[model samples]
Target: MVLDLITIGWRYTMDFRRPTTTAPAQTPEEAYRQLRSLADESALRNLGALYSMAVDDHDIDTVVAMFAEDGSFTRAGHTVQGHTALRDFYIGMMDRYVTTLHIPNSHVITVDDDTATGILTGQAELSLNGTLMMAAYRYDDRYARQDGRWVFAARTLKFMYVVPIEQMPTSFGDSKRIRWPETPYAEADLPEALPTWDSYKC
Candidate 1:
């Protein structure tokens, strides 16, 4: 589905810094290269927002289709790989969310020919068990061009904090911090080849 550009335009436009110089490219080849790079970067950034929208809408099919055939998604120690695994992951875990809003803060992507790496920061507000929670998170991603389109090769998410809306204190002065803890992926529930964030370069 085509996401509303206005929904994400503020972040995308501000984050993608076009070359300010009006100096003409030294050669036609250089001009073409610059244009190609810009296109790739735009596509990559759009993919990031699209992915979040898929999650928010509980559109797992679109999410899976956005990935390469062998792509993987990892977050909070749960890793799902390929279409089959992703379907299982979403059906059993992702679909449980009653409501969600994923607002992307920024996505900084570095493109290199057909391959790219990016870091994305965003806030996720979700309802669970009738309670609202907001999570500040980051995604470390790797992308590759497949069949003339950018697809996720791998995406790993790290959560900085998950704050309960009702219980959030007015201040945190000397208060103990709360954050997601590391847990090993359930071997019996997921594929054995689930990759880690460290395996990808960004």
Candidate 2:
């Protein structure tokens, strides 16, 4: 009986005291800043994905938009600059190639007050025209923060070699494939624990 009375008294004291709310509420400015930060992060992730898609589709329009006006692509003793130059380069590449697959990795974005810089690594495979050469390359990309947005500032591509030329099968008059090459441009495997679009279950 005494223990029950003591418990009732404690409960009454807790109810009367009213829990002290110590946490400070965010100010209006702080809330806005946090929302903007989230928006910027989303933009960066989407930008990276867009870059991958543009190169894969050989979409010159999208590719040009991804870079700044003076952005440069450097590879094989050549540096292509500006949107017009970029268009010329892409068109020329398409004429000499059937397809290209570009994959970007090791992404790092540094935000500074009003500006940011993004550094990343990328790899590509290009199927050339006329010859059965497979061009394999890796890239180091630099992006700039402009007008509250990020854009590619420069890109440098390094290639080990244009391989698979020796494995080309002889041309035949018919549609049937007679000779199979020992080596082909096999797609690179995704890293372990890679998250696919289907994995989201969205």
Instruction: Name the best candidate (by lDDT).
Output: 1
Residue runs of model 1 more than 4 Å from their true location after superposition: 1-24, 170-202
Candidate 1's residue-wise lDDT over 114-186, tens digit each?
8987778888888876777766677778899999999999887765556567545641331222322233212
Q: List the residue pairs that clash in candidate 1.
A: none
lDDT score, candidate 1: 0.69
The candidate scoring highest on TM-score is 1
Give Cα-based local distance difference scores for all models: 0.69, 0.56
Per-model TM-score versus the true fold: 0.73, 0.54
Q: Give the TM-score of candidate 2.
A: 0.54
lDDT of 2 by residue, 1-202 (tens): 1111123211101111122222333898867766665566567767877877886787879988888899988864489999999989978876766777777665555444454444445655556544455433344455677786777777765443344545323322222221223444332212211233245576
TM-score of 1: 0.73
For model 1, what is the error of residue 37's alpha carbon versus the real structure, in angstroms, after optimal superposition?
Answer: 0.8
Q: What is the C-alpha RMSD of each candidate to the true structure, in Å?
A: 10.7, 19.1
